[model samples]
Target: MRLNHALPPDGANGKPVGKEGDLVVRDDELGALGNMAFDLHSQLSTTGDLARQNTFDAATQLFNDGLEAGSALTVLHDAWNTKLGTLKEACAHISNHLDYSKAQHAKDEHDIQTGMKNAAGKAMTVSRIYDYIK
Candidate 1:
């Protein structure tokens, strides 16, 4: 039986291999990268906002139509009669896109949360790309 804790029999140095380089942000290049990331996220978020609005409108119509029928049973019946799979797929796509946007936003926010030196009133971390750049 072989022991799992046994060291390598030959050319093995047990020390950690290499240093992960510290990313130094050049103010100019960092600014440019930050701007690009912010713009991409903002555009994605805006698109999601529009899509969310459309969803609200459609869902409201569905709800209103369901309610307009005379009986509570009709409302209950309509609720159960959903094409929920199709709706779930649509929502999943939107949610996936929103998650992507939030990921980009979170990268900058992580910098802020780590107490990086930045601009004043930078607490709206997701929206403030300038604070995160340098």
Candidate 2:
């Protein structure tokens, strides 16, 4: 719909004529007056930064951004959400693989160590028996 009226190009020397029944006085044109009203609200806000604000915090600015430049912020939001979900899933899968690898490695090491101990004990017993019989 009628997003911005822009003060009817501000006349010849960048001044509003302020005439009665002018196109600048239409419904959409009336919104330009809101910019002046919100200027006061901006000073009273808790957050100092202007870019990061909620819908209610800086409604005029938010609406202005939404209406500016044939805007398409919804696409940006959807892309961000999709990428975030993918990253989360990838991290979870990597964590699971890491846990499984550690468990398998520990089990393999334990088995190799147990086998070596058994072999050494048997070799020692056989050598002792051979010496005893000699």
Q: Can you tell me which runs of candidate 1 are displaced by over 4 Å?
A: 1-24, 67-134
Residue-level lDDT tens digits of model 1 in 1-134: 12234334553964323433333434455445545555655554555345444455555666677754335444444554354334444555555555555566568777656554345634454436464666
lDDT of 2 by residue, 28-52 (tens): 3333344433443344342332333
Cα lDDT computed for each candidate against the true fold:
0.50, 0.46
Cand. 2 Cα-lDDT: 0.46
Please list all clashing residue pairs in model 1, or write none if there are none.
none
Residue ranges of candidate 2 with Cα displaced over 4 Å: 1-71, 115-134
lDDT score for candidate 1 against the true structure: 0.50
